[model samples]
Target: MNRTLLIIAMFCSASTFAQSPVINNAEIDGSGAQYQGNLGVNQAAGDLQQQANARAIAVGHGASATTQIRQRLRTVVDPRIDARSSIQGDSFSHGNGVLGVNQSAGASNQQANAVRISIGTQPQSIDDSVLRQQNVTLIINSDPTDSEPGYRQIATSDQAFTGSRGVIQLNQSAGVGNRTANTLSVRVTD
Candidate 1:
């Protein structure tokens, strides 16, 4: 009797897994408007609001090179203008929200010296009212480079002009090194 019950349960689980689930009241909508060339919001905030209601998920199991990638990318354009003109954006947000990336890895390796680079930026504008109550945040994490790499380098720069409500803010940082042997080498290549 126990063996019979186990077989019955296996059949039930297999049947349930084979069926596709349904979504109630499912639909998709999109619209656009254009005015003077530069002044229009080709993609409206309300449209993005609708899409953001859905949960987003990405999963990579095993070797990513051997697996499939599913993605959604937005391309916006004015229908009244030339057919070839359009703006494709990989990132967009309104008001404010958080963004993040998390990476974890297990390793067993040996290597020679290597060179690589990663770059990014975020530019924002807020009303004086909102700006007064908040401060912008910037973060950079170099992980293996931040810790293990002996030759560390960092640079920061700023420039601003005066005129108006009598307020100004500035911040700066820089790092430099001179030529050395084993630990940290700073060579001049000209």
Candidate 2:
């Protein structure tokens, strides 16, 4: 008796995330006694997660099993911000003021790929092979010259404050890949 068995499986997963450009302009002016608290601006874009799994099994005489899994991810982003504050004239009392700006583009990406193959047959000869491939691409533009169109300039005028001030903060980021994981397993028995 002669028997032949063949099994082939292929799995492909692709994910692409693109974030649009961000532009912000802010201006504040005070002339009299003013109290401001908890003032903030935030922007974020392009976050993705993906997973893929494949399995193949063959059981017989002269059996062959093959499995392939591929995962790809791409991200692109740009962010821009501009802020200004001015306090003119006398007796401009400002107390306990907090101001902040946060910008994030193409951040936090995760991917997982898994493959399993199993083959069983009579006692003779066994051959097994496994292959895995991963590709990633990222592009980001966060800084530009003053003459370029993507650049933003803030006012450099002097600010005058008569009272106490709290805190001022600014944060910026682009193209940050957080975590990635891949797994593969193959088994053959006779």
lDDT of each: 0.19, 0.41
Local accuracy of candidate 1 as per-residue lDDT tens digits, 95-182: 1221111111111101111111112132222222211111122223344443532222222111111111211111111111111111
Q: List the residue pairs that clash in candidate 2.
A: none
- Candidates in order, TM-scores: namely 0.15, 0.34
Best-performing candidate as measured by TM-score: 2
Tell me the tens digit of each residue's lDDT in model 2 across 106-182. Answer: 43333333344456564333333343445564646656555332333333224434563754333333334433433
Clash totals for all candidate models: 0, 0
CA lDDT of 132 in candidate 1?
14
Clashes of 1: 0
lDDT of model number 1: 0.19
Kindly report which residue stretches of model 2 are placed more than 4 angstroms away from their true locations once superposed: 1-48, 78-110, 122-131, 144-175
